[model samples]
Target: MLTLLVIFIFVLALTYFVTRWAGSMQKNKMAGSNIQILETMRVTNSKYIQIIKIGSKCFAVAVCKDTMTFLCEVNEDELAYSSDSRVINTEGFKTILEKFKKDKPDN
Candidate 1:
């Protein structure tokens, strides 16, 4: 029983290390890729709309389980982004919570 438990723990650790190594290798392989997913919105369980940047152009695409359809090309100037060029919520949770509390109706 003790031997079996030791084997299970060893297998788990080995599996974790292997998974991490593979992920790092894949990340390195894609480090120089020009294609990047700028954003994605889910419309259904299996359907999504994604904004992808390829080279210097951005495109909107509709993705389904097995198919991808090009929607349109997006103008970069029309999109809002932070100074770092990534779309992010600048508001802190505490700020949003305080605003919500102030807006709540009194009992």
Candidate 2:
């Protein structure tokens, strides 16, 4: 009976470890896929850095006319972020980006 209990405990521990490892692997794979998506983008005259995700959104910090803006990509929509940026949905984010893209260039 003691031998059976020890074997059962070993199997339980193995199952727990496997479950944790699978979860971690899924997270890593998701991160990598998102990274690939973030890599494909175009930034204009601004001195832009590449993307780095903080949480849900992919972000690029850039400077235009000595001001900082965070360019965020969220679900195919883009957001131009300043200090006062509000959390936005995909459509709102795209609208903000369209407006930003239409700005007249500073001389």
Candidate 3:
């Protein structure tokens, strides 16, 4: 009876560890290279405005339940970023969007 209980506990621990490892792997795979979400604001319950940086360039986009709309492209020079391990920008996304609109010529 003791041997059976020990075997069952070992199996349970192994299963738990394997499941944890697989979940961590899935999270790592979901975030790929060079795509960073700088900021996001909730416009509604299911809608948001997001700023994303792809490589050296950045963009502002509107995200809804069924659609994603490109709002504008942001210039890197307009951003004020802190030099740190986790490099986050000090300037607000709204400020950048306004600057971008002013600099962009109307067609």
Candidate 4:
């Protein structure tokens, strides 16, 4: 019983460290990529609206469970924004969350 407990604990700690290491590696990999998802909003259970930044351009896309439709390329000047306009700020996420929360049923 004691041996089994030791083995279980060892396995758990090994898994924890390995997972943390892999996550850091993945984050580093993504940081060097040219394409990034700036923001995403769920339109329905399986549908979403996403703003993605690829290199110097930004795109808006409608995403469904089985398909992704291109909406348009967003302009930086639309919101009096700078070149980094493609990236959604924390306030934008907060607003989107509030809108969804208000629309969600209490049940």
Off by over 4 Å in 4: 79-107
lDDT by residue (tens digit), candidate 2, 32-67: 554432342345765545556555666665655577
Best model number under lDDT: 1
lDDT of 3 by residue, 32-61 (tens): 779888778899999999888899899999
Question: By the lDDT metric, which is better: model 1 or model 3?
Answer: 1
lDDT of candidates 1 onward, in order: 0.93, 0.64, 0.87, 0.85
Each prediction's total of clashing residue pairs, residues at least 3 apart in sequence or on different chains, is 0, 0, 0, 0
**Pairs in steric clash, model 4:** none
Ranking by lDDT: 1, 3, 4, 2
Writing each residue's lDDT as its tens digit, candidate 4 over 1-107 gives 99999999999999999999998899788778998777788999999999887988989999998999999998745634347755645475688899999999999
TM-score of each: 0.71, 0.33, 0.55, 0.68
> Looking at model 2, how many pairs of residues clash?
0
| Deviation in Å, model 2, residue 33 alpha carbon | 2.6
Q: Which has the better lDDT: candidate 1, or candidate 2?
A: 1
Off by over 4 Å in 3: 1-15, 30-32, 80-107
Q: What's the distance in Å from true for residue 45, model 2? A: 48
Off by over 4 Å in 1: 82-107
